[model samples]
Target: MTGPGLRREVRAGWSLFRRDMLKFRRERARIVSSLLQPIMFLGIFGLGLKNVLGGTGPFQELDYIQYIFPGVIGINVLGISMSTGVTIVADREFGFLREVLVAPISRLTIALGKVASGVATAMFQVAILLLLSPLLGLTPGFVQIVLLMSAVALLAIATSALGVLMASRIRSVESFQYVFQFMLFPLFFLSGAFFVLDRVPPWIAFIANLNPLTYAIDLFRHILYGDIELGELSRSLLLVNSPAEDILIIAVISVVLLSASVVSFVRME
Candidate 1:
């Protein structure tokens, strides 16, 4: 593309991004609910499970709340990022999407802009969670926070793309929500977010291995638990892959999903 064409595309992408952000800002209920849902999960599940799982087996030395903190954040990121796609379905229904579609810029720019907005919103919620981390007795330093944010950002890229891909095809908001939740819950449960993957049955493990969120959560634990020493069993169960491997896997998924979503948007009616 020539300089002027590139500039026009950049401006178009930014405009789409800005529009989503404006919507995000005006939705007061969305901001409140997004933060509340995860806190409820962390508090209710963390406290409840602590009694049952704490001071037992691999969790004997680990703080159960601390162990699942990153997992909770992963859930939040995954959920919010994917929900961003719902806006597209709504846009189509309300006729706003047609305006953007008529623009001369490539469809890829529009898809990416939407994804970028979702990533931004997810990260914003994550910042709030990280601030509340110390309340749960988890204190990550500056560098640790940066590393965690970087990983979460990458995870958001793939998830948001997946959402956009689905939204591109689904015509109704109701249907998109139904289909998204159907997939989202399974991804979270199979991600080892609440339990160790290694101890699960072979069938579950095999399915979890294919889930992108599984590697994402495992990557979170790998970073958050980097300095903490763990027993052989705990280490094996928690850290599914090395940092390098986790990043590579998530990166590959992000590329594939992003490419597919762009194609979906290009073909979208």
Candidate 2:
């Protein structure tokens, strides 16, 4: 604790990551349930809606399932990653987090560790969805596959930071549910997950542009389609700016939220 160094942080992060993974292994039912819900959404909602809606627009030539695969992956990342905050609350209520708080490490290290573990679990779920995408008519190239994975990692990190920030603020389970409902739905709806941003109203478009999840969805969509450049949407009248710009904004937000969360956790201790 005398001086924070790269090696110290990495070691601390890995230790916490391993501990959380072990806890998750013990709660296998919860893990499976969390993963299954998204898979069901992909199968029922994506496939079922495809039957009714038909095909994607000019910008996207993929089938319904393929088009939404990116969005589905983003959703899984957002949902599972943000839920890690609840584990912190549970740890606090059960007195386990108190011991961790007193440990000889920076609170930032602890927060990073928790976020890393959550991201890992979320990535696992995303990978499963990707593997099953072929049945949904997705035949992404090797490059698209790599880009998709990178996008998932970025999203997982951003969402996890937001979760840590929320967990630091909320003190009870009931309040957590209320906040989760208030925050999660709006993020998903405004993210252009279910529809194109151009199809929405101007006011809603403005809000969607501001949502970090919007950048995430756009990034995934850009990679999946391989025909459209996400940066163009950002440059157009929709006022999304550029893909790099959105990436920078998201990165800044993640860092700020994460730093604030770590400060709050340390203060609480």
Candidate 3:
């Protein structure tokens, strides 16, 4: 007979996942609020920058909206991933995490449930953006669809693990907010989400290569446009040869971070 422990773990995991899903559904306003930032960047920033490109072929005709669209997608995922981290800290603060920890369930099961909630949230945000893509002149084909989603899934999981790992050690949510603010914007700009990497100086380019978000954006760009150049003046900025290579590197990072999160939870007990 299967032990009661096994059943308890599964039940707890499902309950946690369902709770988050319901919470996400209830907060419908967040969907609109979250999208506004990306839209603003595309509209205000991109429109202003598009005029200066001198209409180059390598830029796909210097249509700035198309160049920055994938980065906008990154913004959506990063915003949700970070918010999920806040919820984890809130649970710890409010005694909900204590209640869950005391129960007869494996810590891995709980961690996976938490990670799943973050991943689901990101995908929901992505779905909204995918529907809006045509308005920006991005029409992903079937294969591109698969590639795009696969990249999003891998990146989402990695980011969730990172957030969870951070939350695990930090006792207070306020501290996390401080640290997160420092890390988040740097990652966004360093990822080349808003601009082509070609014009960036050598020092900045070197630092960007070390950021995981850089590879994630590379995968997004490759899959979305299929070897097309977002800027004519720039050489190929990809660190990896293909989207598959990018996915592989990110998968490794995800596994490492997920393992670290599991270990952190175990240590917390």
lDDT accuracy of residue 197 in candidate 3: 76
Q: Tens-digit lDDT track for model 3 on 21-68?
A: 998888889878887878888888678777775365445443567777
lDDT of 1 at 222: 81
lDDT of 2 by residue, 34-123 (tens): 778777877887778887766434323445666566677787888888888888887888898878888777788898898898788888
User: What TM-score does structure 2 among the candidates reach?
Assistant: 0.86
> In candidate 1, where is summed lDDT lowest over 10 consecutive residues?
220-229
Clashing pairs in 1: none
Score each candidate by Cα lDDT: 0.89, 0.75, 0.78
Per-residue lDDT of model 1, residues 1-269, tens digit only: 88999999999999999998898999999999999988998888899999999998778767888878888999999899999899999999999998989879899899999999889998999999999877876678888889999999999999999999999989999999999989988888898888877768889988888888888888888877766779998788668788898889999999999999999989987
Q: Give the TM-score of candidate 3.
A: 0.89
Pairs that clash in candidate 3: none
Q: How accurate is candidate 3 locally (lDDT)?
A: 0.78
